[model samples]
Target chain A: GAGVSQSPRYKVAKRGQDVALRCDPISGHVSLFWYQQALGQGPEFLTYFQNEAQLDKSGLPSDRFFAERPEGSVSTLKIQRTQQEDSAVYLCASSLTGGLGNTIYFGEGSWLTVV
Target chain B: AQSVTQLDSHVSVSEGTPVLLRCNYSSSYSPSLFWYVQHPNKGLQLLLKYTSAATLVKGINGFEAEFKKSETSFHLTKPSAHMSDAAEYFCVVSEDTGGFKTIFGAGTRLFVKA
Candidate 1:
């Protein structure tokens, strides 16, 4: 709506369990990004999408970390077989265009804890 | 390759005192630099950015950063510190090489003492 929105603000998952987080970027934005932030650290880029096409997935930590923006509007990040080390905050951001010159807006983020 | 380094892990200042947060970056090409602030349990908010425009970039909340190409630094400064300014600050660098790649610094935590 007004800004980037994320779902499941907080999540607790058992080790080896699968979890999904959702993000809704600002309407009509053309670029979307996902980042992972650990305690006391800055957010690290996970992946990027230009419209519905996934142009870059190089930053995904592992194969288990999958993100998809199927329709170019809403996106989802899925983590399989979650590990304790995977616990962190997942941030979603969107920009008006697909480059670095534009200002990217961020969501509150989804906090995940693996137990 | 592009990278950003925030010099201090933590900084403490009394309310109303001058504030400074240092940042340096390395980029292969002309880089876009940015400063973002994150409050407790809140999303990141952009403070300011320096593209190819003015070297002195002003942002909201009385924050400003100057892009120095000679030293490859974009340090953030404020004339005075406010209690509300206590938060984590991050320096970011972006370079477009086929992909829009962005790198973030480790972050500096600002503590304002009253």
Candidate 2:
């Protein structure tokens, strides 16, 4: 794809249910990132991957949230036992290289509504 | 740590008026700064970025920002506001922590009144 692509653009998950959001980054990109944005707020970092390696998971809110880019291209973010507070937009971004001064491309994002 | 602060939560300007969005940042190292805009229900788009090369950076849609090391500020500005410019703007600071870890400010919602 020419840009980062995200699947399940919108989802409504019941409390205690699990949800998975998928992201396909730009081809040959070496870095991928996940962010969570609540209503009227800026996106907050969730995790980061350098190719297949999960280099940073410091921003994940809890153990219930998990992300993986097993093949260094496609990634998935899973929220287990979703709660009401989990409602937000999950954004995926990728950069050509993880190096300094690289521009990161963003996807449209997955809107999750926990009911 | 690195952090960004957007001074205003909301800013209103009449169409054709000048626009200014203030941003301040704190970083332990020389930071890479960026400005991103988000339209309603749309993904974020990069407006501009400030690398080490230039203190004044030009961006798309007639937007520009100046990085002032002494002030620790990277403020976005436009000579005139367009109706299409109404959107949310975020200030971001990226630091190298093995890889770049970007931190975003709370965002400023710009409203252009006709």
Candidate with top DockQ is 1
DockQ comparisons of all candidates to the true complex: 0.80, 0.75
Runs off by more than 4 Å, candidate 1: none
For every candidate, C-alpha RMSD to the true structure in Å:
0.7, 0.7
| Per-residue alpha-carbon lDDT of candidate 2 for residues A1-115, written as tens digits (9 for 90 to 100) | 9889999999999999999999999999999999999998899999999999998999999999999999999999999999999999999999999886789889999999999
Please identify model 2 stretches exceeding 4 Å from their true place. none
Q: Candidate 1 has which clashing residue pairs, if any?
A: none
- CAPRI-wise, candidate 2 is medium
TM-score of every model versus the real structure:
0.99, 0.99
Distance (Å) between predicted and true CA of A106, model 1?
0.7
Worst 10 residues of 1 chain A by lDDT: A96-105
lDDT of 2 by residue, B33-77 (tens): 999999998889999998898799999999999999999999999
lDDT of 1: 0.95
What fraction of the true interface contacts does model 1 reproduce? 0.69
Error of 1 at B83 (Å): 0.9
